[model samples]
Target: MEIDGQPLWVAPSIYVDSKEQGIISLGHRCVLSEHVMLLTHDFSLDRYSEKMGIAPSDMEYETKGKIRIGDYAFIGIRSIIMPGVTIGDGAIVGAGSVVTKSVGDGMVVAGNPARELGTVESAWERNQAQWQLKRRRP
Candidate 1:
């Protein structure tokens, strides 16, 4: 819940962790879709101790890294944002993407491991064409 700026839209089912340092940092104009999980840590069985009566499922594993999303980034539905991920400005994550690494500025990523598909330049081109068509339509 550490939002660094304003005009953010987050879906209801987004799982956000705010306990650790920079666990979730959302810049201005960021959009998080439904069921998107912004995780900071992973629970491991090694943390469990039999003598301490701690169950493996009850072990707590803290975040070794942070999740930072820059301005104007859009995280699609059901996306899993792993720790230590810095998403640059204007980046777009497609639906159900599992982001394991940092995404470059204005890039489009999708699928498991979130491969870079293209850049925002393509989107800008499409937008320009639409505008031209509208102007020509009278």
Candidate 2:
């Protein structure tokens, strides 16, 4: 759907876990792959809940911060992005990766902690070459 000129696709199963508010800002054409989770809250085990006067539910806690995914970004399937993260423009998060930090623009990252796997420029160039080769074949 288009929200103020930004196209966002939130998967039906995508869960936004937050307390105060859950904000998912998808820049132009930001696609939230299947089973992707955007978390906005966190609670310490030692912390107490004001309502229950007891430990808070693991899924229910005060919001830590908001999450913003930049423009033209592709998040692979089953990626879990933690609270207070701003994923830079054109960044790609590989599938099944746990993102604890903000991703830089034009970078492809993967793995549990999400380390930089490659630069966007290199990946683009490689894709272009492959496209050209395929074009020449037919």
Candidate 3:
């Protein structure tokens, strides 16, 4: 587990799995909302072990890989970042998203498989417009 800078906000309920042979790196100003899960390992081999009638503790059933959240990345509430996933700088993961692949810089992703929605700049623009509209309402 390596956090690169200050002002990294992580909610209390978030879970970071760093017990495996991989690294979980959170970059500068990264925000992890409540119930966000940063997973560093996969249990795909567990089914194989079950089929072979092998004891769980007798074999290695976990595949580990690094999970990197780049600078200024925002992981929304209840989002799950899978193993070997790298979220680039300024990327945003929408609430309840399950990120299965790498997200590029400034990209906004949402949904179960976390498909790219748009860039961070677009999202910011939309937010600003909404705020301006609200302020104008009399």
Candidate 4:
């Protein structure tokens, strides 16, 4: 596990599987909320078992790859970041997201498989507008 720079916020409740040989790198100012899971390895027991004509329980096969979270990336609570995923700089992952692929810089992604919703700047602007509206309400 390699964490670079200062002021990175990783919640204590988050689970990071570091037993595999693959590296897990967290960049500057990255924030991992509670219950976030960073997986560096994926089990291939079913596929291996089928190929070998054996029970999945009897098979011990895994695919390992590095997980890199770029600078200023924010992983929301209960999100799962799969192996070999490189979250780009300034990316925003919505809560409970299942990230299966790499996120582009400043992109905002949400839901299972984590599809792109919009850019960070647009989301921020929307948020600001909502805040202003709320302030005007009684």
What lDDT score is found at residue 19 in candidate 3? 68
lDDT of each: 0.82, 0.76, 0.88, 0.87
lDDT of each residue in 1-138, candidate 4, tens digit only: 777775278889989888654398888989899999998887756686767777555556778779989999999999999988999999999999999999999999999989999999999987875654444322
Candidate 4 Cα RMSD after full superposition onto the native fold (Å): 5.0
Clashing pairs in 4: none
When sorted by TM-score, best at the front, the candidate numbers are 3, 4, 1, 2
Which residue pairs in candidate 2 have backbone atoms (N, alpha carbon, C) closer than 3 angstroms, thus clashing? none
Off by over 4 Å in 1: 45-63, 126-138
**Candidate 2 similarity to native, TM-score:** 0.73
Residue range with the least summed lDDT across 10 consecutive positions in model 1? 129-138
What are the candidates' C-alpha RMSDs? Answer: 5.3, 5.5, 4.7, 5.0
**All candidates: TM-score:** 0.75, 0.73, 0.84, 0.83
For model 3, residues 67-112, the per-residue Cα lDDT tens digits are 9899999999999999889999999999999999999999999999
* Regions of candidate 4 where Cα sits further than 4 Å from its true position: 20-22, 46-59, 131-138
Cα displacement (Å) at residue 32, model 2? 0.7
- Model 1 clash pairs are none
TM-score of 1: 0.75
The residue-level lDDT of candidate 2 at 60 comes to 45
Q: What is the lDDT of residue 54 in candidate 2?
A: 67
